[model samples]
Target: MDEDSDAQVMLRVAAGDRKAFALLFDRYHASVARFAYRFVGDRARAEELTQDIFVKLYRNAKAYKPTAQFKTFLFRVATNHCLNEVRRGEYRVTRSTSSPADEDEKGVEAVDAQAERPDEAVAGRELERAVGEALQGMSERERAAFTMCRFEGMAYRDIATALEASEAAVKSLIHRATLAVARKVEALQAGIGPERSRA
Candidate 1:
């Protein structure tokens, strides 16, 4: 749906229109789940978190202002929920493996397993693990901003609104997080090739 239509639907949702609410859920569920998965790096927990986030959104629908774009507003809810979940220490962030089928179910584009060389696939997994580990080491705000900007492809302005931070602050957070993740991935790549020790 277009932005204005989304806002109108949300207005209907705020008025206790169940169908409108369902429509919003259908439209955003996958993206919300993917954001959660990227945030926590756990598919099962991400699923749980997505459900919780939607429940919270339903309860708080009255708080939504039509002035904000629905996508940003939805992500504001999602970003805050994710930060709260992590801050509560509900789970430790870890690299949870997902099969290609599983990622596909979540609307993630999984690499073609048949097309990739086995060694390249292994390297890709290692890089994912490295990036996940780097994310795990980040502060809550940094991680949230980073995931929104990188994984979700959100603009900095939208991310700033979702994060309730200044655009400059969001920029700083993403920059640091990106640099850290890049360093980890680079180190992992360096270790994978010429640096490997021979038995």
Candidate 2:
């Protein structure tokens, strides 16, 4: 079925349809988990968060409104949960440590940094680390906007709906986030070049 059909299933779920809820979960579980992983940067925690999100959805299904798309509502719930976790310091500890080499990192590679040689591969990894650090430094809203826009390829209007912000505000958040990440990456690369020159 087409994605828009998920909203119909959600409406059925609102009316106490167990099968509909299962269908909804099956349709979105992976996407939600991936989004949570991007926000939290921990696979286990992301899985937990995804489970929590689905549980919340089940409980709140009666409140579902078709005023917007179902995906928008789902992301809105996910974003709020992630931001709360961030505020509660659940993710802060992980953010302090460097991201380990993981399969999940492949999903967050919004930039296509082709590295043909061994040195370039090392540089690519360093650049990815620097970008991850910069992301950790972003404010919750900025990070959310950047993730949705860059990693998820969400449109600004959809992001604004999920974030409850104006489209202009979302644009500004993403632009500022991009500039901040770029500056941090350049600084990191500058430091790396000097060390390499000395070697």
Candidate 3:
């Protein structure tokens, strides 16, 4: 079935179909977990949050409206849960100190080192770290907007719906976030340049 058929499955779930719910869970669990990990930066906590989101989805199945795309509804639920966790100070973006097991289990894409020299690979990892730090420094709304647009490839209108903000506001947040991250990355590159340049 087409992936957009998620709505049909959701309708079935709303009508009390456990098999449909299971299919939906199997389809979206990994994606939701990855998005949560990107937002929270902790594999274990992201897994917990992913479980909570699915539980919410199951409990609120009757509220699913076909008016919007099912993906939008799923992300809206996820965004609210993540923001609440942040507000409660239960979420932390601390990938640097995460345990080896957490890193191994994390679903975020790693810096690709294939066919690259050692120096280039090192630079790639450094750049990835810098970008991650830049994202963490953004305001919650800005980070959410930037991540949805840039990483998740979501349209501004859909993101606005998920965030419950105006499209213009989402655009502004993403614009500022992009500039901030770019500036930080440039600074990181400069800092990592030759020692003679720093002298």
Candidate 4:
């Protein structure tokens, strides 16, 4: 089967095409999950948030249009849904990252080792933990702007469009977010090991 452009898929979806809907789901579900995970710093909430975005898409498929990139439309919907959720204060969803009892019994060292390269795993875990903590520390707009720009690699114009802010404003959001996150990461690295410090 020929791969359809997202806009084409949406056009089909709007016409009640189940296959196109399935294709969109298959294409974006993971990205949505990761986007949520990066924002909320909780895997479970990330999963829920991702599902919620797709739900909105499914419900609104009839309204789909092709004036912009399909991802741009998808992100616009996703960003708005997340922002509304933030406003409703419903994201206080609670979950835990504590290791399962079975996993813990295996070995703390085994759990700590996450990278394929044995030598890199310990540092990688620490870095990931630090970044996760930093993400939790950010404001909603900062996190959204930062996540879209840094994680998704969206252009400034697209981000400004998605966010409905000026390019300058978008840049400011990303800059402030980067500075704040970088400071937290630097502080964390400083507290680790002298040999571990890259800067």
What TM-score does model 4 achieve against the real structure? 0.77
lDDT tens digits, residues 79-146, model 3? 99988988888677765776534543442242342336878656665556666666777888887888
Q: Report each candidate's C-alpha RMSD, comma-separated, in the order given.
A: 4.1, 3.9, 3.8, 6.2
Q: How many clashing residue pairs are found in candidate 1?
A: 0
Task: Quantify all predictions' global Cα lDDT against the true fold.
Answer: 0.77, 0.78, 0.77, 0.67
Q: Which residue pairs does candidate 3 place in steric collision? A: none
Tens-place lDDT per residue, model 2, 30-143, is: 878877876777788889999999998888887778877788788889999988887887665244343445642544456666689989777677666666666766788998
Model 4 regions lying over 4 Å from their true place: 1-4, 39-42, 92-116, 192-199
Model 1: residue 184 alpha-carbon error in angstroms:
1.8
The residue-level lDDT of candidate 2 at 5 comes to 94
Q: Model 1, range 3-92, lDDT digits (tens) per residue?
A: 899999999999999999999999999889988876676888899999998998889899999998888889999999888887787676
Give me the candidate number with maximum lDDT.
2
lDDT of 2 at 30: 81
Q: Pick the candidate with the highest TM-score.
A: 3
The window of 10 residues in a row where model 4 has the poorest summed lDDT is 102-111
Estimate the lDDT of model 3: 0.77
